[model samples]
Target: MTFDPTLFLPDDLLERIRERAPIHDRENTFPEQDLAELRAAGYLSILVPTERGGAGLSLEQAAILQQRLATASPATALAINMHLVWTGVAKVFSDRGVPGLEFVQDGAVAGDVFAFGISEAGNDLVLFGSDTEATPQGDGAYSFTGTKIFTSLAPVWTKLGLHGLDTTSPDGPKLVFAFIDRTDAVTTSDDWDTLGMRATQSRTTRIDGAVAAAEHVVRRIDPGPGADPIIFGIFSVFELLLASVYTGVARRALDLAVQTAQKRTSKKTGLAYSQDPDIRWRIADMSLAYEALPPQIAALARDVDEQADHGALWFTLLSGTKHRAVTMAKHVVDQAVLTAGGGAYFSSNELSRLYRDVLAGMFHPSDPESAHSAAASALLGPLQG
Candidate 1:
């Protein structure tokens, strides 16, 4: 059952992606070519079942492949994460005998791209609350109206998986999770200008009267966090995949540092920097931090696939893994940039782009604060209020 992860990421194809990454970043454009090739390669349906005409890869396998993809281009991996999150959630639901998300499975098999639209401005109650309003149509459908920020894959996502608040329901205020296809009512803003992950084209999205049909309405749950399968599916899949990408970034940075250390020579000593004690120590330190992440990701992802219960500790494990992966990636890239010397300071350098790309990790869900809170809660119980 164990397969080589590298087999999913052929070096020649990855080299093409890697070559275009900088150009996409420079131009502040989406990786259209990257998306095309990945779609052609059936990567968009990695989580869909074999019966659904997909590769039928498990979450652990998908995580490994994501890490490999990120080593070539982090933005591409991150953007694609949105689509995979939906498919992964569908897989989770299907595995648990949950209904209502069959659309995701069907869509992915048909080559549809799904974008995550759970984030909102100033709304930190992620998965528990929403600023967008979902008006009940009384026939199982709902019309959503609000702006979704950080909508990755904004340029080409065929369906958006988002949540909104439904205050009109007789059941009182409930968070509504649904899928909306791209329609005239949905608008994507071209305001994705940023310092990192620029190739994602994760622009602002405005949905005005965007409706999720009766069948597309997936979950209607109470507005705060609880033991909801949808929430668990989202958090587990998102965190694991996000962590995988950053882990790949860390590995790439560590490898680059090794290569730089070996190639750069010290003019005064007439020896390669790899021979220097300080350079060797730095590389060793980076490697030390980098080595622990892949196993952690693989183990956690396998646990998810096998439905292993970590109980209330699930959030802690997921968030902690993501936090550590991002933190380690940043540290490794810092060392790599230092090892690459002044040339890396240029905007065109791969290390420079990576240095910027890694920063966006801190901004994702289960952020540093949330991760610390989850860990603290797991260890000592929730802080006495």
Candidate 2:
């Protein structure tokens, strides 16, 4: 059966979300209402197994829904992406016969919001390493002590899925992946001011000996990137979903450009801007760039769903797709702003807001530099040394 995204995220619900986007952006706050409505709709559990009281959608289907959600509210989609990443990871684990993250899947079904707490300032190693300290409590529990930056869903996440270096283990410097609750030891800083994606309110988090119970301690693997299923799950889901959101941003920009071209009339030509040769060419160029990404995103997402072994090239393909989506989104928004003319320069204009929101794409993981390096390594092997 072909999965229909509209069944989950209908147009009316999306219109409501779209209406609230500007308000959240203007206030620089989290989209609480959007979260409530989406939670009510069971959107948070779309990746969990149907037997577990979820939509049981594949990663490919989730990507399509994410793109649709992003078209209505990019910030909402981006914030929700963090929660979905954990559930998606759980699905990945379950599908591969891994047993640790069943709690994550169940938590999502029970309405527990899981935040991705892996990002740390100055820790460019990302999943490969962690600056945080993981102190084992002897009985398999671990206490995390470090500050994590860009902790999306900071304001409301019920559990945090994070990584830290457990140096005290006899195993010798294993990266411990665990889930900790928001206790008194955990502090969420109110410092999420940014140029765009403001509605996310992705505040910084400070963890001072926040402990993950024994059952919540998921993976304890050696660092520096290997074929761990957890690593593959995180990287694939994160990169593909990030790409899907930005692809939706590009789609919205292209749609706005078309609407502008059809509505705005040219004084010189005495016809709609759509009839102008230059404007038509610009729209066509935007269309060309926009048309290429969804298929790539869909293909990679399906490959993940079917567990198609892309082997060592997985990183390159994932990162490159993300890079292309973000860059293409930025380009389409730039053209949309040009097409809409000076009116779009105003802050109230949706095009202007999109112009700001799309700038955030370059900063996500698998950034252009990292993507190019992975691609280069795939093609020409690693640099000597």
Candidate 3:
């Protein structure tokens, strides 16, 4: 009845996610049960309009919910983010009265899982340029052919929201943003083995001729970045949700560090490690680094919900927030591990997994380099050629 995130994502559900997280990570498997539970709880429809039979939550609410979810299982939260991104994008467009992605919202309510199929190997021009070919069918259809790497939700996605280059179209050199149903032409490779976030199962996808029907094509924008509503929506939602997940990871790690410090008694001090000045200081450092992220994510998400435009500055702010959240999460986790001592160094330790998971933050979109570049461009100006 209410829009309370905690009500939707209760502690009991989170406890289940937390309990199963290690098993999924160790098995290098997708958290199918987590997906099932979330789906049953209507989590997948959080961003859909209430008129469309969904929770109709704002981005700020979704961000907070995702942070709570991530505190239980970062991999599950990250995996589901691909789905949420599509719904969030659709919500953004609908909120702005641009009406085309209604089907995305509708499909989410119908229990369709949407995978984000944008990342390509060595393609740093994320969401701007694409190596995938969108061969036009002359009848308002396009058959995409390319290898899309890091395709999260690979095993269970019902639809894929992707972008590709349409070089031979009448509108030549346009980037086609569309959603294609999973078909025989699409192949998911079992190549998700990685350093961490193993439960994500973000495998490589090889597409020979994935077709997007006329009604499914959402946007046709010029190659390279611009002020397209679709692009802005994707960037805003993606970065904010991402920042929230890593921020949650930091929170979990910080809590674990405190627990370890409080429970463990030091031989020299004859008291709990929490009393040790160095341990306390390290925890404080982790806290100091961790505390500023949630309010920032909340404020920016509120801005998005309110349609408060910052024009060209949005990219800088969004990317910078993601960059800061990730970097800060990693720093906090590092300090947490230090405070946790030798026990955390063991592979079986939760702190050890958190350390590995936090490392993955650097690799997502708005990498440190890109974030700095965007921020610099915003503050100073684009670097002289």
Candidate 4:
């Protein structure tokens, strides 16, 4: 059967999201209405299997949908990206015949919202290590106690998939991956005010002895990077979806630039700016930058879906793709702002909002510095000890 994104997110829904984006950005509030609409559309479960009562879409399809959503509302798309990451991980597990995360798929089908709580302040070794502590309860359950920063979907997530260090385990130290429901032990801070993507309200969460039931505890692997499917699943899905969001931002910026060029007339030439060689060149430059990302994202996403063995080159490719998407999106948006001229300087201008929102790409996982380091190591081998 053919999978159509519009079947789930029709044009009217996207138009509504686009109209509300600026309001959400101005108010700095979570997009509750958007979330409600997306949930109704079963968007949160797109990555779940068909038998599990979801759209049963592949990671590649999900990436395409994310890009479309981001073009309408980047914050809404970014907030939902966290939920999709968890479901995408569950899909990863199912594809590999791994057990234990079936519950996540079921939860998604049952309308549960999952938030990514893996980020930490000052934890440069993301996905490889952790500062949060995960103590075992003698049974299979574990108690998590630590603070998680940038906890997206903070105002609404029913469950949080996070990792913490389990130091007292017999294996010395292991990174415990688990899920915990919102309880008294979890305190969400009301401090999500930011320069952009404000509607995400990705506030700080302090987990004070939050318990993951025995069944919810998924993995306990040694820290500092390995071939664990859990790690690979999170990193792969997170990077690609993030890249999709930024790519959508670039697409929207390009469209706006073209529209402005065609609509605004040049006083000097008595013609539309689109007719001017310099304006045409700027728009063409933006197009060149924007055109490279979607296909790159599509190829990498397809590799993840097919489980293509890029082997050690996987991280290099994934991180590099994300880095390129963000840089290209920023460049396109900058050109767009230039093309749009003084009117774009207003806060109400969509291009102005995009300019602020695209900056967040730099702060997500696989920053340019890390991306470069990974590429360098992939080519030159690790620095000598």
Q: Which candidate leads the pack in lDDT?
A: 4
lDDT string, candidate 3, 123-182, tens digits: 999899999999888888888999998888999999999999999976689999998988
User: What is the C-alpha local distance difference test score of candidate 3?
Assistant: 0.93
Give candidate 4 misplaced runs (Cα > 4 Å): 1-3
Worst 10 residues of 3 by lDDT: 1-10
Q: How close is candidate 1 to the true structure, as a TM-score?
A: 0.99
- Residues 1-385, candidate 2, lDDT per residue (tens digit)? 8788899999999999999999999999899999999999999999999989898999999999999999999999999999999999998898888899999989999999999999899888999999999999999999999999988888889999999999998886999999999899999999999999999888999999999999999999999989999999999999999999999998998999999999989888799999999999999999999999999999999998888999999999999999999999999999999999999999999998899999999988977889999999999999996
TM-score of each: 0.99, 0.99, 0.98, 0.99
What digit string (tens of lDDT, one per residue) describes model 1 on residues 136-220?
A: 9978899999999999999999999999999987887999999999999999999999999999999999999999999999999
lDDT of 4 at 168: 95
TM-score between candidate 3 and the true structure:
0.98
RMSD of each: 0.9, 0.7, 1.2, 0.8
Off by over 4 Å in 2: none
Angstrom error of the Cα, residue 236, model 3: value is: 0.2
